[model samples]
Target: MENVTGLVEGEETTAGEAEFYDRLRPLVASYCRTPRIERVAVIGNEPLGSSEERAAMVDSADLVFRVNGFRVDELGSERAVGRRAEVVVFNRGVRPTPWFFAGYPERLYLMIEPGRLLWENPKLPEFWPQDLGIVTMPNREVVLPLGKALGADPRAGGQWATTGTVMLWIATRLFPDAHIDAAGFSFVDAPGQTSWNHAYGDPSAVGVEHRIDLESVLVRRWIDSGRIAYHR
Candidate 1:
């Protein structure tokens, strides 16, 4: 609705973004655990928001947190921009591109896309057992407390030490009756960087391909194992 001018190219044009948003809307409704998303966070080099973006979010997302460092002026404007959103965009990129921000929860779903982030970072496995990989990572890194000192992307792997694990992790502090669903190469068990690249299209769309069957595997394990908290 509001004319989105001056957006970075490649997923930045108004028509382009509108199409992306159009694709994203029903996709979430179709794929997510619920018609409404409870709450969500997406941390990346860039930030995208629209009034309908709020409506597009599955019904559960009462609040949406966007964490990005690149756009300072635009950051503050997010609140005003997405009038329909109970949204907040944090300006965390004062420094160079490092890892994901740690000011949120302890454990989360770090969206490691295979496009932008991986492209900029030729170095793979900067950190070990990274929050999640752009796609498949060496099986060795998938340990508990999720290892930190490994060979994954330093930015991604550093999260385990800083707060938890990931170049970026998006999770809910107040989780509810929810289920987990993620997509992409890792979700389907496709291996290698090439497969990851082909399957996921773009690395910046971390939150996109992430699917979950975690209600049984991850959530049940985390809560029942006394590993994580499940609250209202």
Candidate 2:
């Protein structure tokens, strides 16, 4: 498929897409309301290693974000990774479990498709739950700017940022005044690790689409600049 900044062939904006944005604007407005978000926590799928306080800290945040395939079971105990998920960010390729879809209408769902930078409309996954309102990030508005911030060149293939990183970027952009913290990320420590230690499943090899080496540098830069308070 050809990747471009404008609409791809055979793709057209639809009413459903308009409705999705309509639902999104209000949710964003609510977050940006008076008193603003004081603290924002972004939780990754990695297991929380030996930190008894991580879960409590995550739950205490005014806004909590979790990425694809997140779980709250024994594998992802409340004592380890927290219980609240006010914002859930997922990629189109994720094969999320039933628990990932729980607590509907109460949480904000945002789908990030870096591929949408090459195409216009989003193709909903077959497993996506019906009747749920999800806001799909616009490529030009979200992905492109983020890619540039990470020093990614569009000419360089296979450099797409992972959904977790994009979620963190989104949190920083939407709630600029909020104190942002993150945990359960392993990229900084194990950038070359070939497989994932996801909270919900057996280890799986990392996909080639993500350049973790680049992502690690950006994340470390964020930590160093105090843009994010990273916990192990």
Candidate 3:
């Protein structure tokens, strides 16, 4: 991987993207309520150690952020990542499953590609029963650096950061004052072991849009800088 150096820290955004983001800021702030959160737990789908301990730690946070469709069963099993998710992150095409709506998150952060609009999707429900707020993903400004670092246009989609990594990035941007703790994300797999990527999906058919190597590179950079606390 090439050195990110000055790029990741110096994010440059076009005026249009900046204006759209500025309009969205108030919405996010209203939904998030407090600008300076104390702590947050961003849960990933990777297998974790001591599920009970991890769950306890996660639940103790001021807010819990879960990615994709991760769920917890009985609070002590491997399936139990966290009991509650205050913020749920999902990609553009992937809507939240029934379980996600039932969990009742404070906000649903939809990560969209550059030219795509969520309202245009036919998959959106006619009415959201939970009365949840919505926040667009990638936070363009925050993701700009990562995209530049990886030589990929996040808005164009295809071969970008994994949903887990995106959620991690969102947490850092949305809750700037919060100390973030992440569980269940092991960024890389050994040779020939790449098949076992997520906890629920069929390994061999896990799809290629998620660029784990690029995501891993950015993740390692964050870990090294103490930006996020990772629990493998």
Candidate 4:
């Protein structure tokens, strides 16, 4: 992400690129137990700058966005991220963007319980996942309790379930008493090709953790059948 975020001198490598092979190696091993993942695409939030710059980013994402074609300027951000990444890597919990900005301490302080603090904060209500956890606020976008400056813009994904959503703030829009009743799973990791690190979300919570496990399998059949693929 240092490279992607332009944090490094010149351009080195995208953070997503560095983590790609290692992330899938374990998942494939636990599932296929042999090499299957060859090519990978590490993507980030849509670029925001000059028209040419944005166009270039869109062009490069052709392989990365198999489900979404490069949209024309006539339209706008459609469900934000286009799709839940076939594979995503989050930066874990520690947010670095706040420190860079001025007056950050006042942005994220929590007085009540973390949950209470979240709901009470005027800006943070956007981060709450809703529709039975079908959606959430985009990274860097949730209005922090103390931090009024949002680090990232809220994003949405198009899914069959959300047929008529009104594009409300999802990340900070948690239910006032939304704690679950069931016990959490004991698995070491989540099961999916998608993965993330702190940059994508809080590591302690589920956002940035690598979305794969021993049972996690990237089906080669999906590729063969022309489903769930990059570089079509």
The prediction achieving the highest lDDT against the true structure is 2
For candidate 2, write residues 1-232 as lDDT tens digits. 1111222222223465445445564586464323457788898888766456887788778778889999754454337777778888998878886668887667778888877555435678887778887877876556665676667753356367788988887776665556787887788788898888887788888877677777888877777667688886
> 51 in model 3: Cα distance from truth in Å?
3.2
What is the C-alpha RMSD, rounded to one decimal, of candidate 1? 18.0
Residue pairs with colliding backbones in model 2 are: none
List the candidate 3 regions with Cα displacement exceeding 4 Å. Answer: 1-36, 73-80, 95-98, 105-111, 114-133, 138-145, 154-157, 189-197, 201-204
Assess every candidate by TM-score. Answer: 0.24, 0.81, 0.70, 0.19
Residue 217 displacement in candidate 4 (angstroms)? 2.5
Off-target runs (Cα >4 Å) in candidate 4 are: 1-57, 60-195, 198-202, 205-220
Model 2 lDDT-worst window of ten: 1-10
- lDDT, candidate 2, at 103: 79
Better of 1 and 2 by TM-score: 2
lDDT score of residue 75 within candidate 2: 53
Cα error, residue 73 of model 4, in Å, equals 17
> Which digits, one per residue and each the tens of the lDDT, describe model 3 over residues 1-232?
2112211354334575456556654554554434655777888877555556677778777777777756554533553566666677776555444456664655555554432421235344555554665556544554555566666665565445667776776666555556778877766433223554555543443445556667677766666666677766
Model 3 is weakest, by summed lDDT over 10 consecutive residues, at 1-10
Best by TM-score: 2
Write candidate 1's Cα lDDT for 1-232 as tens digits.
Answer: 1111121122122354345334434433333343575443222222234333332332234333333222211233433122121222222112222223332222222233233322334344433345532222211222211222222333353222111112212222122222321111132122112222211123432232222222123333333433222221
Displacement of the residue 53 alpha carbon in candidate 2, Å: 1.3
Q: Tell me the lDDT of candidate 2.
A: 0.72
lDDT of 1: 0.27
